[model samples]
Target: MAFAVTSSTAIRSSLSTPLEQPKAAQVGAFQPSDRHHLPPAAVNFSRRRCAVKPLNAEPKRNDSIVPSAATFFASEVVEKIDVEDYGKLAKDLGNASPLEIMDKALEKFGNDIAIAFSGAEDVALIEYASLTGRPFRVFSLDTGRLNPETYRFFDEVEKHYKIRIEYMFPDASEVQDLVRNKGLFSFYEDGHQECCRVRKVRPLRRALKGLRAWITGQRKDQSPGTRSEVPVVQVDPVFEGLDGGIGSLVKWNPVANVKGTDVWSFLRAMNVPVNWLHAKGYISIGCEPCTRAVLPGQHEREGRWWWEDAKAKECGLHKGNIKEQNSNGGVHANATVQEADLFNTNCVVNLSRPGIENLLKLKSRNEPWLVVLYAPWCRFCQGMEQSYVEVAEKLTGSGVKIAKFRADGEEKPFAQQELQLGSFPTILFFPKNSSRPVKLSI
Candidate 1:
């Protein structure tokens, strides 16, 4: 699905970019070329209950939003969404049709919310929003590298809908810096994350910061791994909104459960305009350089970032959907295997909270240690086990300790607060001299 963008100056202020570069390592040492920007401060999620309720159980909802639509959402219930009631909103609307879900979202948030418009599925969202007969907002990110056909389609959509599509462009200085240092197509060699951050994710972050909620075109069928579990509605796990921090931004995926064939049918029936790239077999379109057309019967995600590993398909926009679980099943589904195989090695030291704390207290160490804060369920972490084991074996006599910290389940918050842990497979290099560790982007 498509995401929002922002004016360069605004994005430059709001975006916290992550760096990607090659690593030059030594025993117990690494010259880190990675940089990460942490959230401004942690936003506490109060009710530790599940964000999605039981689909069969009738959800108990108090109009978390106002009863009547307004120019902007002056909330009828100003209470936060992560509390008991709104937490179950997604499941309550889980089985509802896309149109019904769209109506509900627009009715609740009013002009305070906006649609991240682009792609076929997203344009369909606009059509559904229009059918609701409500005033809604739509925005998009212009990466300066989109297909010519996509640009024409954008103009056609604005004309057809009789609406002005607010556009967010990438930061000029950031783009200039990247091109000057890395050249235009560095992503082909290194990766797409750095380029995408400047073009899409950062601008979208700025766009979301001003709103209470957003609507997306994400569907399970759009991609294989990342969007599989997207809910029709939920408190955003990743970006913050006008109210600030996690749980503040509500993301509504009206077509989360809709399939590809169904979306096409809806569009056809409604006479919705689609990008010409689709006719060329480009089922999943993003920036021009990265996306390509897929062959028949191929999955849509295959069109985007085809060069990268299947697990690296998702851009930073919907990283929350990068669930830390393997294809096998739910979290801790591979507990037995993890105990016997994953990270259970002679050279790798598994550290608990107290043990890690004690290790951090050391002002000077006999050797450097490489620690990975990871979850057993994360597929990415699972894939890297062999490589990590090999490194541990190689460094055995180098006085380097390759360690791991279990950051899943109840220990997640502690890992987040103390260890800067945001996702699975976090690798931090604890240098020999000081406790401060630098994260390596690999």
Candidate 2:
């Protein structure tokens, strides 16, 4: 018999108050929500209803179906799938709504399919999956550097959805090794690829080791240059798994055709818990150190690794390859140096070795200046470019010179030694006649 699943009742019935919020002590102290003061808005869900036949009620057919992992006693046999079949299926469902695509996926893969929840689009996927009244799995990559608000949103999602989210973390030893050798923020000096590989890619690989298929919230419009051809379903070329063995896995992008506005509309309409940072202009959320809110009229990708070119926006999680062409003839060989002279100028100056002497002369005049040490490849720095420029324009009359230095280029040593930089896009305030520079919080 077909069952009617009202979104409100289904969500309310499934959601019981979490016994306790998950502790994030190892990462950082992030309070999810106060027990007495949990905002109703965060948990409010849409009342829209739909009808779906439960998998158990449907007649058993020849289609290969993996039993839910929750049924531990069931057979652990892996299902063999033809790649050609999924390619055809992707084409058929290419124009389907996100919910319809999700329903088809859950029916086929059962618990073997898992949602790779990042923040926005993933949550919308979860809302649709939950409405189906079928058991499914969800996982997230807890890159050690996620914002505290992201952690809070994670908890809120769990409490509202009534599901346990498997958070995959980088191996402790691997993280320790990377941090020990390269320092806390090595991505600023060498580029973000290496750090992302250690913190995000490896952990995600481990997480997908057991799943047969995975889903993401990638949209074609998000990165037209890189993700323009994203299909609703395709074989993941990079990672492997299906029944916990090494093999190509089905990858689903149910919302690939949906716009960002549509995702936000669903979130608001469904009252799905979302990362609070979104309200502050952070469209695409990732590691705290790497992400920032974009200015008005900026693209979402700009909020991510902004220092890189448009085609290189991916962090090897989706696209799988992180290698960049070393075609520069080693011009960036001194890229690792951390000490250099700062340039002085009246207006917004791009500081470098040639201008260092002039900067010193300006320093002697006792004028306060705001200096930004940034990497050209850092996405966060790129997102803040317009705002910083505006700040400089406004401060021009106050005798305050806004200046910047490229830490990833010729002035790397200057940023490393003089700034004592820990992360990319470091900003400092030098007061008149003071030998010390106060690090300004971004």
- Give per-model TM-scores: 0.62, 0.56
Residue pairs with colliding backbones in model 1 are none
The parts of candidate 2 lying over 4 Å away from their true place are 1-84, 243-247, 320-442
Total residue pair clashes for candidate 1: 0
lDDT of 2 by residue, 262-363 (tens): 888887787666777877899988888888899999999899977765655677677521222245622222121112222212347776655543554454
* Top candidate by TM-score: 1
**Per-residue C-alpha lDDT of model 1 across residues 1-442, encoded as one tens digit per residue:** 1112222321221011222222311111011112223333333322211121112222232212111111211122222332324547788988999999998887666555788886445789888877776566678888998888788787777656655566777778879977998899999987787788678876777777766788999887776445667788876766766666455667889999999899889987876677778878888788889989999988888888999877677666776654544347753321222223255556799898898887778888777778889876565565455456656755667667789988887889988887878787788777788767767665
The 10-residue segment with the lowest total lDDT in model 1: 24-33
Residue 144 of model 1: what lDDT? 91
- What's the lDDT for residue 349 in model 1? 95
Scored by lDDT, model 2 comes in at 0.60
